[model samples]
Target: MTIMSSTSLSSGLDSVTNKSYLLHFLQLLSTCMAFFLVTRESTWSVDISNWSMFVWCFCFAVTLLTLIAELCGLQDKLHFSWDRFLITSACYCALFCLSAAIIYPIIHLQIFPDGSPRHHVIAATAFSCIASVAYAVEVVWTCARTGEPSCSLLGLLKRLEIFVACVIFAFLSNTYPSERQPALVWCVAVYCICFILGAVAMLRHRCDCDESLPYSCLGFGQSVLAVLLYTTALVLWPLYQFNGDFGGQPQRSNELSCIDELTSYLCVWDQRLVVAILTAVNLLIYVADLVILTVVSDRGSTQGLRIPSSY
Candidate 1:
């Protein structure tokens, strides 16, 4: 074909691809909105708050990322990626815990002084563990449902275990006697968990899975954007909720503190920004995948991919 013909064809293809991407994005957004509304326990439901949106968005992001990756031939199979889900879950768990550490301490320094208890710290850790385990169960279930290696392998499950363990350690770093060193230890734990698990999620590894993201779907650009969205939702939005250590009181309480010390961090104000942050990040990832698929329509273009797909 002539150069002009080739350019026109490329432009046409790009336009069609963009339209399809937008359509797919709309569809996913609509579905996740419904899911979020229903899954939102009534007590936790609020208009546009942190706890309300953080994890809600995160899970949606992970699933959405999987779908986009599939479209770009990024996955061995198109179903939800358990490994991706677990890493994201752990990262969000860390974020939720950190939000708790900051918002909680400031919210009740007068009442708790020493800063709640080791229970809150531990409970947050347990939350990450449970979330990781839950996702592993999901991975196993997906494999069972599909009868494929994607779900059957223990490598991904074990990798998830590694993330969960890291999260637990990070959280426990603060669960020591409260008075000795509370805020600093807890905050450090949160950062540690976020960096370690978030890095793993953004990259990825298990069995034969390639750790780096697809050139089209993820990069420093997308990762930074995800973090920005998360920080905006999870940590920043809650500043308004504060008013001198008393305004935002816990509306809920952890009944399961006995089940595990970490599980006990539950309180009314435990609403975290994780759901929102995750949602935003996942949404971005999916968009990135679409862009990649559109821009690099053939194997030839992917020669630029120094790293393989993380789907």
Candidate 2:
């Protein structure tokens, strides 16, 4: 048997803890910066801006709470109970779907116009696609790890809600710009109601569990649907552009005007740069999660090892 000195063990733990904290801090910083840039530079409609703000804010809150929990050594307390985790994850999954819907048109229309030499439009589009995949993976991972039926059920409901929202948005995009706002607002309101209903149901049936197999299948279905919808939107985006059906007219001139006046701050930035940074940060977080999961699984397996009684 090999032994580690107490000091060496403690030092190793400290190194791991510090690395975790650094990653969290970087996530918080990148998210905040991206939010700031989007708020200032996004030339999309007010509805899209509002939705983007909501996503950035949600990310900010999660990261902040996680950082505080880590520093305070209160991670266990901060862990979402299985039910809460399902509900929260469902909500985020829905939000990501909505994001993909909104971003698709924006990228195709060049709403934020990639003036940067780095081809920000392609980067932004790539990030949006990757982010959607990340969200889907998160939903499925949560369900699989918890073996919770409600998790998959709630995810299904949210995915359907997002699918309907995207369809409506696609239809509206073909309509006159002046007429789309009210319809979009109403659609958002209805989805919000549905989301709330799902949450309440989750709360009411916290202890409920059906066989995991059906829900696992449903979870897989939901993920596939999400990827399909997002990719479909991406493919349809260029068609919308070519047909001149992306809103009433291009707002590129107005966006350029806004950028010119922001010589002090946002002028130097473009959506792609912000998006690339956010994507990197999200990838880091995903990698960190995988590492943590591996460590936990290894420790559990080690603890389970036992000599045969016959020996």
Best model number under TM-score: 2
Candidate 1's TM-score reads 0.29
Worst 10 residues of 1 by lDDT: 41-50
Model 2: per-residue lDDT, tens digit, 147-255?
4444433234333443344333333332322334443343334433433443443344442322221234343343343344333333333233223464322333443
> Which lDDT values do the candidates have, in the order given?
0.39, 0.42
lDDT of 1 by residue, 29-134 (tens): 5335533433442222222223323443554565477557646766555355544443444334334334333433232232222333433433333443344344
Model 1 alpha-carbon miss at residue 289, Å: 33
Could you tell me every candidate's TM-score relative to the true structure?
0.29, 0.42
True-structure Cα RMSD, model 2: 13.2
Model 1, 47: alpha-carbon shift in Å? 13
